[model samples]
Target chain A: MSTRTVDLVDYDDAVRRYDPVLGIEVHVELGTVTKMFCGAEVEFGGEPNTQVTPVSLGLPGALPVVNRTAVESAIKIGLALNCSIAESCRFARKNYFYPDNPKNFQTSQYDEPIAFDGYLDVELEDGTVFRVEIERAHMEEDAGKNTHVGGAGGRISGAEYSLVDYNRAGIPLVEIVTRPIEGVGERAPEIARAYVKTLRDIFRALDVSEARMERGNVRADVNLSLRATPESPLGTRTETKNVNSFRSVERAVRYEVSRQAALLDAGDAVVQETRHWHEDRGVTSSGRVKSDAEDYRYFPEPDLVPVAPARSWVESLRAAQPELPVERRRRLQGEWGYADAEMRDVVNADAIDIIEATVAAGSSPAGARKWWMGELARRAKSAEVELAELPVTPGQVAQLQGLVDSGRINDKLARQALEGVLAGEGDPEQVVVARGLEVVSDDGPLLEAIDAALAAQPDIAEKIRSGNLGPVGAIIGAVMKATRGQADAGRVRELVIERTSA
Target chain B: MSTISRDEVARVAALARIDLRPDELDRLAGELDVIVDSVAQVSAVATPDVPATSHPLPMTNVYREDVPVPALPVADVLAAAPDAQDGRFAVPQILGEE
Candidate 1:
């Protein structure tokens, strides 16, 4: 999180010497019920072998059936990103060696991704909107998860043995790539984070993948290079792999920018290779280099028939596109009457959907925002759960606020009831009833408690009688305490005033 | 099209992790040449205007609900693992500690 002042003298010389350009390829696992080309369940963290089918396991006689739902999800994502859908596409083999890939080769779309030539409008916090041009978004299968144990550093070296889970294998993935981005300059890191955040929102809006960074559902591979200025030929770029979160993406990019800049300043030519972003250390280490164009031995997948989606089908998909994240943010800002900062906070917290649902459940927009952005958000953080997953319902929230509005319960009591409801005690009203938390609106019991307090504290009562109305609050507090906060303090205060005065 | 040498075919097979016998490499080289030659028909028909297609079906704007669901059970996932321990898949030692 530290930034160094660029040695302008060195940078000036380097600028005359070199320029940096960047590109990013992001892979998002679609939240499909099944695998891309098989019926095996598309899930993460499963009992390793249970989800695999013959096709996903790459059985000798197995044939990929092409999950229709996964294809549709890919198309939706493509259109949401403002990409053009190709009328016809075919699957090709991407051959590679890795034990995690059961097939030893992946079935992917090479030249014919589902969508291409799109752009994503990413807005930084400073209101600078960068149009990241999309090169393509292609559909492919994910490899299994590998656990390299007993390695010297838990990497591929000195490993005694390795294990892999195929639960992630064959899961549908849409890799959205961006062309080398220029003019990002110093804003490179911010732009990187914002772009991925915006993409997460779009995925949520389009109902594609869950886009959970922690679970590796959506991952970013940041390609970074450093140059003196915008006008020079691009320098060699490094690819950082599997950055799972926006923060890491930004950090990785910024680190690479500095590292590469420093390297270039030292007159060292930047190496074109893959790097690993160690999130813990906030530095990138070397991975394998692509010395040559890897010949994947790609060819048409003979097992499955070629997909020939009709023009009408593509049109229908386009028509069915959901409101993209940018549009949704703008609309929600206007509809909720929230300031730009507040809306941005909601988006950053990933609570826009929850707030929207709460509003839809009859809560005032401002009220919904307040609760979600405040107590609910706090509770979600404490429990490590999403805001929407909290047990309290929107109707209950509105009903609790309604109780406060009608003076039937104080704010503190309402909060207590909320906790009760969140604990599965029931709705707001039910929690209030079950806990005997309703205010003593009748005032009879409150007056009796106030009298008892007065008898116990004669000097304080005399002070109240001597026109010290502030002391009346003492009696009100006593009465409320006696009645376990069920007595309305305001009404008790009024009774205490009248009695003390008389 | 360049003719694939037997040595080249063997190297590719090694990279792909498929063990091929010396005799098999030549046969594979011939077969690969034939396949590559046949598939090169794409180049003949492909014009600058003819876009290479990667997906068989034309699709755009497909989506699914973005809700996070439970990951598959660790036990279930590990059941398929060739090796596992302590609820995690175990693998061979990889890198020397820095």
Candidate 2:
């Protein structure tokens, strides 16, 4: 395992001495109900192999058939990435003998891919557009999961046995491989993160995949190599497998650059191998070496037919596309009449998705923004959780705003109800019922409170009758205090004016 | 065809996780040369106009609707495995090797 080397060159020194080249291969599991080549259902968590079909299990007589929605989703992803749609593609058997693959071969694309020569304009958080050139995005079937058990942390080493779940075996995947990304020295990590984030956003916008990195839907393999200079030939690269989050992607890139630079500096060559990214430890350990001699013996699958997408169908998919994120953000900013600073705050607070969903749930843009970016955001910050992971849903936020719009509660009470909902007090209405946080719209009780306030502050009430009405603030404040701030302030003002005028 | 070497064959065999005897490596080197030459003979005659065809038959748009179908029972699925435990297919722990 290289004995856990701590001699990593400084990041600035590493970039100065060597040019880092990045080749990111993103694997996205399609959200199709069925498996890629079989009738096995695709689910996130299922009991063992219960979702496995005979084709997924690689039974002798079982035949393979492709899922139509998976192909359409692949095409949509390609279109979103500005990739050229392939006229024809075929599945090839990637021969490997692992316990995870029941058939001992994965059906993947090799020479022919469904999408080729694409480029994605990845805009970093600083609004710099780095064009990451995509080599190809091809169709592949995912391997079954192997859970190594009986060891400390269930590591593969010292484990007594490993459990294999074939439920994900035949799930459809679009493996997007990028051409070697070069020349963005210190910003390499940021570029990598932004690129993946852009891909995730595009996937979600296209409604292709769930695109959850935590659930293994969208995974990125960071392939980084460091050369002495920009003109130097590419150094032997190490591929870090399945970095599952945006933060980890950036960290992996930076870690690889430093690690590889250290090896090169010490007169040791970086081995061309796959490395396992330990997210917990934040360090990559060496995996299998991708030797030139170790061939997968890729050949066309005999059971499945070739896929030749019609140009008309591809065009139709492009025409039916939803608004992508960048354009959508611009449209939203215009539609909501938000200034640049306002939009930036909304985006920075990570409130875009919640606000969008809240708006979709029948709340005004201003109302959604005020609730999500204001009170909910404050609570979410103090709670140290994401806005989406808050106890209250976007629907509840809209409901809370609806109560305010219907005069059931004013803004202040709505804030309390939102707080109550976030505290697991059920939805806004239930919170209103449980906490009794509502506006006192009844004039009878409000008038009685106003009369008491007037009784308490008769001198200020008399000053209002002679047209010096400034001291009426004490009467309104007194009434508000009596009603526990639930009395509508506007109504209290009008009632105080009426009681003083007589 | 490139001349195959015994050492190269041995290295490739090790990479493939196959234990090969010295004599068997020598025998496979000679056998693989013939196979490589035979495969090269066909490629020489095929013209560039013929695009590379991976599939045996030319077809397109072969897809099934995404729908629920009966999966094999867990017992049936686990029946073919070398080992099973807790309704899961079990294997010797992979010690970070092939």
Candidate 3:
């Protein structure tokens, strides 16, 4: 397919003319202890070939045995999305030739998936509920990761050679495919992002996979098409493969809409193929032409048998789902007394979990929100790092707030202590001690400094004794300067007033 | 009569990434006929009385416990590979990302 060929119609114009159909396919690796079809364990990155068994390597005599935990996780995901679990389903072999897939064929479900016909009610930032239909969530095995070495980075395009890590090979994955979502006119990009983010939250709540989008634990393939009218035939769709992050998912949908509209506006047929999401360029490039090579001669796998989950098993898994992200957000928003905008801010910052932990560690909800949303967030942004990856933990932040609450440190010193704690000076208390940041609560040292300040500023002290406290700042400033800004100013003022009046 | 042609076998061999000489290609063409016929014969044995079967044995949910067994030694896994570097299976340039 030609990319950036003609000037694309603007986003507003495109949506006004054509209806966008969004189809999302999310593949999540089940964090099971063992590989799907082998005795080998499933680890993310080990010595490259160490995690593979003969079965994973697709050796001559090795056979596969399914991992029960993977099947259970798939069913649980289906139930959370409000899907009907299949009573009986068998594995099918998807035949293709890829070097990463040592088996040369992937063991997946074709027509007979284990779960189907589900719907996920996704709530956007503005609380707009969009119900996305689920086509199926099928069980499959992942291919090995290809790391091409001997170039700038480990990219396969210009690399001298590639490395294969079979640690990921044969790992169980649940591919959740969504039906063609329609009726979302201009909110198409927002809907795509919200749906994927909701699904990630559900996965984490279920404890299925780690569901880290940046790490490729949960990957999405976005299929987008445009039609002239809502009733017209669907236009040729392009599948953008493995858009990694939530933000990228939204950008991919928006980019494809403009690109495809441009192609159609120029009287060019959008070639039906897969494209690559270039995160650096914020554009898509044509990867390969989709042809009969996609005809993956699917047939039932002979090495394995049919899986018919007991009704009781499916029910038990469904019952085990924890409170999903949306429900938790609703509850937390109420408990924390947050307005809609305030709650949206916390969710967008992705600090809901950290804020909850901080509150649990003894900081007030408002206090926790203030510290996290103000100081820590600014630090994270300035350093170009994620908030979760920041060195300070919720408990450390709670300790910092505790010092301020207990009068051991004033708000001014507390800010410096927080910086010291993040810089690895130890906890808040340790940072306070290391940096000598405690509030000067002892009035003896403060009275001595205040008496000296009064002796030096007799005129201002007399003016303060006459009940005009405006000149109290003169004595307080003198004491503050003498103590190098460590002494508490309010206590100095109190001593100055007592001495001057006597 | 074999419906498969010599050119078809060459294309299949190419996809499979095996380089074959002209004489070898001609010999492989006749071998494809035998393999196809054998597979067809297996399908022909299914009658109205018999049901479609995926495996010779009837087994479902044959799974391992959620416990990790040590992976094979690094040397053995690398031995299977044509090349290895820093305990990884290294290969030539890959043309496609998918």
Candidate 4:
């Protein structure tokens, strides 16, 4: 538990000295109705130990059968990643002892995976496309949930006992492993985050998993190793286990790089081990060593036969694939006519869906982007919620933009109407009517305000009468203030010039 | 020929969570060597042309539809456990030492 002794070099200094190599393994829980091998119901937050079958419980004489949809989901994930599907694959038993795994062994794939040899190109913050090659994606079952009682912070260490819930056990999971990503000098951390985000988007696009990082549906195990230089041999690596969020994935890589660099500087070898990420403290601590001693003797499971997906079936799945998230982004960017940086900002903010819906609700692309990225984004940040989770809807935003486009209100008044909508004052139109926030379009009242401004500011109006229009703005400002900012400045200027010239 | 060592036998024993005496490890090492020697005879007869087999019957793609089936009753599920608590299975503390 003591990470105090681990010295860390400065991040920039470490990157300047060492080259980082990263390999990521992501596990996504598929949203199937049943478990991977049994017919037990799969639902989140169910009563403990209730969703279990004899096969899941590893009862004697109970046979296991594979769920068909889980395999299809795995295949879809592979196809989306542009991987070649294996003609045949089998499940192998990974033997271990844990309370979470009721079966003493976890049935996973070894040597033969369902999908392999794929690649995903993720765009970084600056729109630099970094291609991460996919090694394979395999199917496995999840372990049970373990609650450590009488421990400090529910940690496994110093616990008096532990409770196991088998409801989560045996749920279908697709584990995607990336090949060794090399030659990423300083953008290693950003690439790590972007890669995971891309995968999350891909999973949701495929409709296989919920792909929500908050719900533990997607988890990443980040493996980092540092070499002296680009041409040097790979250094001893550390695997950070179960980093559940994108920011944490990026942070874990950065921390490990600095920690390993300090170790090398002091002439100490970086121990190859599984490190646990502490989200609160923003550091990683050593967990267990993965030496040659700890071995999971893997062997094929005899209970289940080989899954030889026919060529025709694979072609059908490939044909039924949806347009991937990356391709969809390109199409949307073209349609919206936004520049590279603008599109990148919209994608990074996760505002693409909302902006699309706002566009569908009859707002122009620039109008939708303006309200969401400028005003709504700031509000969401201050309120500590997601932009989509804000009180205002896409329809309401479009309506507010419509009011601005039709000359009924300026941008300032539109913001006030948005504030009213957020305050639960009803829709944009309702808020506009209730607050009387519409622009003073009637020339009768505008002429009155302009005449009053000209009478009050005679010297400034006198300059406009002498053909010096520089004083026209002063009269317009006065009229806008008199109308409580509901009067349009352009319309006020036109009317002020007419009254002063006459 | 003795192919299995005493240390190897002890390692397998510990993995299976079996506490064996020193004398038993020594005796089992010799006995396991004979078992291996007998199993090695089958490999000698297996030609390169013959492929490996995981199951006897030739079958593939054995699957079940993604349908819900009633799980075993919680009481019945807990009945088989040595200790149960609060609708969960309770066990001694695990330090995650490998």
Candidate 5:
């Protein structure tokens, strides 16, 4: 690896000089029950090497048979992405000497993919619809996990040794490759992030995979190159691999654009190579260099036959496709009467499901959104947790909203009750009852508090009695303070006016 | 005409992680040339009318149910490895991807 540090051009300056073209390849592991080619169970966090079969272990004389469910999942994903299903596809051997794969070759699709030629329209943060064209989505098998021992940074290099676990081997993977996405200009990073997030939502909607980035269920390989202008030829690009998060995908693209711009500004050429994304350092380091030795020399796998999905089956899968994220977002926005910006904010916060649940639990759409996008969202941010990870549930939020709508608790009292709920006190109702957060409904207690406030501030009371109603706010404030902010200010105002008139 | 060169054979051997002598590299290049020529003859007969076949059988979509079978015991699995550590297969340090 080259240790020379290069200066970076500012992102604005880089975009001013060049146009960035992006090609993203996203890999999603299918949530199948078994290995793609064997009967070994597909699971996470199992004993090391315990989930392997003879086929997964690449033992001699053992053969592999395709898993029906895995193929069905691949078809479902393809249909959701609007890709045309291939009538027949076959696997090929991608030969390498890596110990991650015990077979010394990975079984993957080549030349013939299961799905190809589709496009997805992704909604950016500002609600701009950008269509990302799909090239192909192919089926492949995952490799084993290698834990580098005695290594700095836990990379394969400089490690004393490595331990290999075959538990993840043979898990089914569907790699979706996007065609060269041009004309995005400066929005390349935003489009890249949005595209991956849209696919993740689609995968979950299709129920093909868990689609969790933290669990490595979905990973992105971001390929980016900058041209002199939109009309210029494509420049040499770098492939940054395993950018697992949406934010990381965007960051990797921007970093590459800036880094490449600096190289061009210095009159140096960009090298085409594979680079690894370091999430902590927010920079990409060079991985394997491009060379003849990197060639896979792909050939058809003689052990497995072709997969010819019937036309009827493809149509059936297409018909069974669920409402994808884009359609669902549009539907929800219309049904909730939310403006586009409001809906985008909710989606950005990842609170759509919880808000829907709150509405289903009998809260108004506006009310549910107000709590989730307002108080709860603020609380989640402050607590450094996900909106879903907040201790308060949708039902409790709806209950709190119910209390507010019924005038049993004012907004202030509702906020206190919500705090109690997040603190694990109890449900909203129990929290309100336990914390005595109910608004003052009986006029007798209000009368006593009002009398006490007027007696203490007789001059202000006189001013209110002489027809200056402004000082009546003083009485209400005193009463509210005396009542621990649980009394409704509107009702307090009415009671104070009556007392002053009498 | 030589179908495979000694350097090409050396590169393939390196990719396969095989230690090849110079003389062995030259000898294998000659042997691989014969194999390549024989394979080319088969391709020569394969015209557009005859669809290329990856498998000998005419069948397609051979699949098994997704029900899982139990895995082997850890001791049995580790027994097949040349070296084992921490219930995993241990190997020498990889020279790439830091």
Candidate 6:
């Protein structure tokens, strides 16, 4: 759209001589029962003040007590990532001043984190598995939430005042950082999204946290840059932050790539800064530039005791690792015989567990897949809810499938019954019974209806008698409509032929 | 350990906003200096073999459930607000004369 596109050859030449390097820092909130260093409840959306304790609120004379469960969870996360757990780790104070953090300084680990030098194997949508190297995974406490009012769109600028909710304060968070990933070039964004998705899968499998992006359980800070050649020093990078979804992450990276490439092609050097991704606009705007680490003065946290996890403790956590996401996905694909598209749909929807449960509840594999991927998915979309949160149980879904399998209900009627179940009317069988929507497979009633329709339309009856069975569908459709969708079409067709021959 | 002065202790406390008593500040400064100097031993022993552990477990890409579950009811969330108006948290006036 600019002059940069006009000089195609020059741009190609620049790209041929350049490479882009990427690094990412992701923060995931663990699903521990208590705060990171206190006994306050680790929950979202409670009565704001009810979740707070003295330690979480940073009350004077209140000392911090580390939650052993949080430490164990962090250790489990580290071990699952194949990191080396430190025998001894000390919490450091990262000093800052903001309304959200009541303590003024965040207690975190510096210079020595809890885990280091790990790697995650992430597979892209195209089936390319890339190993994203992990730099470190450190544990820290979450700050409280801030709501700025009277601003230009409730942001920092023009804000009249800010309010703080300390419920999230002192919550445990594990931040995982990635080393500089090279050679991705154009596929950098996809790789970033895949990496986050893979991480989310791992968390779910481990029962660590409900990594709902909307709830801010998992968030990513994507760093991107452009260079002149693979051997050249990497160009300056811009970090786009708080990208909460895979699609948004991928889009943010691609946007940055084109934006940076255009700037470089126009002879402008890219600025290294933190950028904010506007999901509504699909654009990035500059926020702040961190040129030095001196801004955050790091010191030891004196209020808490130093953590000295025993070697035996680390070993125990490692031994309890759950089945990894990639392996599970592969195994499920083979077991279900789902094509790539079908398998991807399940993975992307995060409906694998629900589908598996339905199958376990006695539904055929294909039938379970169909209902979850089709009707349930559509209902979830229209109602703005997740398939997992649907009111109908897996056993109910299997029962509904049974009705269809035994020719007791057609696909349309099954869908209607499913809707009723989702509306809390009752289970599928109950809905059918209460609404009198059971399939009319009795030949006598079907024959009466067929004879009445034939007597009214003698020409159509003659065509059916002459062996044209296609029009039978029209008659079947009418009969089913008259019966309020309670009649089985196949049995109605069999009765129609018998009446015509007589 | 070298003793810390009252002036230095006051400065750090003001920066950190603890509002400590004069005597307590003096005692804390001394103790902090000793503690910081002692803990600096980590820098000396830390080498390439001593990998820094951030998390104890080998958890690589852990994810949360992607489905958007319902948040706590708005009335419940706002009930804990220090001040509220029209189902939202209210705050004191912050703007000054333009």
| Top DockQ hit | 5
lDDT of 5 at A76: 89
List the candidates ranked by lDDT, beginning with the highest. 4, 5, 2, 3, 6, 1
Badly placed stretches (over 4 Å) of model 2 are A348-350, A360-362, A377-396, A405-408, A419-438, A441-444, A454-475, A490-502, B15-17, B49-53
Pairs clashing in candidate 2? none
Off by over 4 Å in 3: A1-6, A149-161, A291-294, A433-436, A481-499, B1-52
True interface contacts reproduced, per candidate = 0.26, 0.87, 0.82, 0.91, 0.91, 0.08
> Model 3, DockQ value?
0.57
Q: Write the per-residue lDDT of candidate 2 for residues A201-274, one digit (tens) a residue.
A: 89999999989878889999999999888999888889898899999999999889888888989999899999
For B29-64, candidate 4 gives per-residue lDDT tens digits of 999999999889999999999988887879999999
Residue-level lDDT tens digits of model 3 in A1-502: 3334545578888888889999999999988989888879877667678888789899998988888888888899989989999998999998887778988899999878999999999998878898999999999999998877767576556678887788889989999999999998889999999999999989988999999887899999999999999999888999999998999999999899998998888889998988899899788878776646345768899888888899999888877778888899999999999888988999999899999999899988887898899999999999988887899999999888888888888777888899898888899999899888887888888888888877887787678878888988888888888876777777777788788788
lDDT for A366 in candidate 4 is 99
TM-score of each: 0.83, 0.90, 0.89, 0.91, 0.94, 0.81
lDDT of 3 at A350: 85
Q: Report the poorest 10 consecutive residues by lDDT, candidate 2 chain A.
A: A290-299
lDDT, model 2, position B61: 72
Better of 3 and 6 by DockQ: 3
Q: How badly does each model clash, as a count of residue pairs?
A: 51, 0, 0, 0, 0, 36
Q: Write one digit per residue (lDDT tens) for candidate 4, span A1-502.
A: 6636779999999999999999999999999999999999999888998899998888898889999999999999999998999999999988888888888999999888999999999888776899999999999999999899997878888889998888998999999999999988888999999999999999998999988898899999999999999999888889899999999999999999999999999999999999999999889989888735246778889999999999999899999999898889999999999999899899889899899999999999999999999999999999988898999999999999999999998999999999999999999999999999999989999999888888888888788999999878888888889888999898888887788778
Residue B51 in candidate 2, Cα distance off native in Å: 5.0
True contacts kept of 2: 0.87
Interface RMSD over true interface Cα atoms for each candidate: 6.9, 1.8, 1.8, 1.3, 1.3, 9.7
Chain A TM-score for candidate 6 is: 0.92
Best of the two (5, 6) by lDDT: 5
The TM-score measured for candidate 1 stands at 0.83
Query: Top model by TM-score, which number?
Result: 5
Give each prediction's DockQ, rounded to 2 decimals.
0.21, 0.71, 0.57, 0.77, 0.81, 0.09
| lDDT (0 to 1) per candidate | 0.78, 0.87, 0.86, 0.92, 0.91, 0.78
